[model samples]
Target: MIVIVDYGLGNLGSIKNMLRKIGYSSMVSSNPDEISKASKLILPGVGAFDTGMRHLTDSGLLDILGYKALAEKIPVLGICLGAQLMTRSSEEGCLSGLGWFEAETLKFQFDGIAGKWPLPNIGWRDVFDVNGSPLLSGFNSTPRFYFVHSYFLKPLEQDIVSMNVSYGFEYACGLSKGNLHCVQFHPEKSHKFGMQLLRNFSELT
Candidate 1:
């Protein structure tokens, strides 16, 4: 069964509901044992970087999560802030991240185009598939996902970036490394596009 990690953050129900719509059953749990048994893991989060990390740490599932994602090598998916937390660190906070990727989260710097686009890039945007990830499979056309964030992930390794989206500038919106995958966009909130993406994830080996 898929496990929707409950770390006192994220749209847990929405994610579960979306999965159910696509005929995939999932459990929302903070219990380490329940998490350990998950066939696939979905790390969903909404809010500040440090707060999410703190809650996950306090939940006492960090070690098990590390083991599952690193050792067990189960298919792990992270959404939005959860995706940010998978990086080495974020400019939003000082606390270290899960460091699953050699990357860092940074606030959008428009520079010359600062005032043109505001913070919290909130809207629907098309993603450029860099490395065709299985999670993005079955799309006939360029898929667009909903995004709502001020900061974006910048990975040191260019090859891991699965998708890129343009806000003030093009940035890594999706990442994939081995069995771990993450997206900055809110697939649960993106209607058919989101549903298809989740469906693809459910079908992953």
Candidate 2:
């Protein structure tokens, strides 16, 4: 079963509904034991990164995830702000992240560009594969996925980036380091491509 982390941060209902529609068994809970038992763990988030960490820390899930990720080596997938939280830190606020992936969340400097691409990059856009992650199996190099975020995680190694998308500039749209994987786009919100992506995640060992 897949466990969707619910820390009062993201759209828990939408995510649960999508999973059920796909005929996948999943549970949304803050209980550490239940979360640890999840065959695949999905960290989905919305809103601010710092607030999300506050909720995770408040619910005592930070330590649980940290231990499970490094020790057990369970497959953990993070989406959007959830993905950003997997990094060591962010420029948004004070709270440190779960630090599952060796990366950092940073605001776009729009290198040489006159203006920023736009905050909260919402809507459907193409994402191309970089690291050839199993989560993107059968999808072409550039497949569309729903996106809605401001900041993006910059992983240390090129292999950590699974997909790349262009806004004002190209940034790491998908990332996977070890058992920790993350996507800047919203697979649940994405249309046909989104559904298949979720299915691929369930197939991960």
- RMSD per prediction, one decimal? 0.9, 1.6
> Per-residue alpha-carbon lDDT of model 1 for 65-84, expressed as tens digits?
99999999999999999999
How high a TM-score does candidate 2 get? 0.93
Q: List the candidates' TM-scores in order.
A: 0.98, 0.93
| Residue pairs clashing, model 2 | none
Clashes of 1: 0
Best by lDDT: 1
Instruction: Give me the displacement of residue 78 in model 2, in angstroms.
Output: 0.4
Model 2 stretches astray by more than 4 angstroms: 114-116
Model 1, residue 47: distance off in Å is 0.2
Clash tally for model 2: 0
lDDT by residue for model 2 over 24-130, one digit each (tens)? 87889999989878778889998888898888888988777877778888888898889998888999988888877778999867768866567767788888778
lDDT of each: 0.94, 0.83
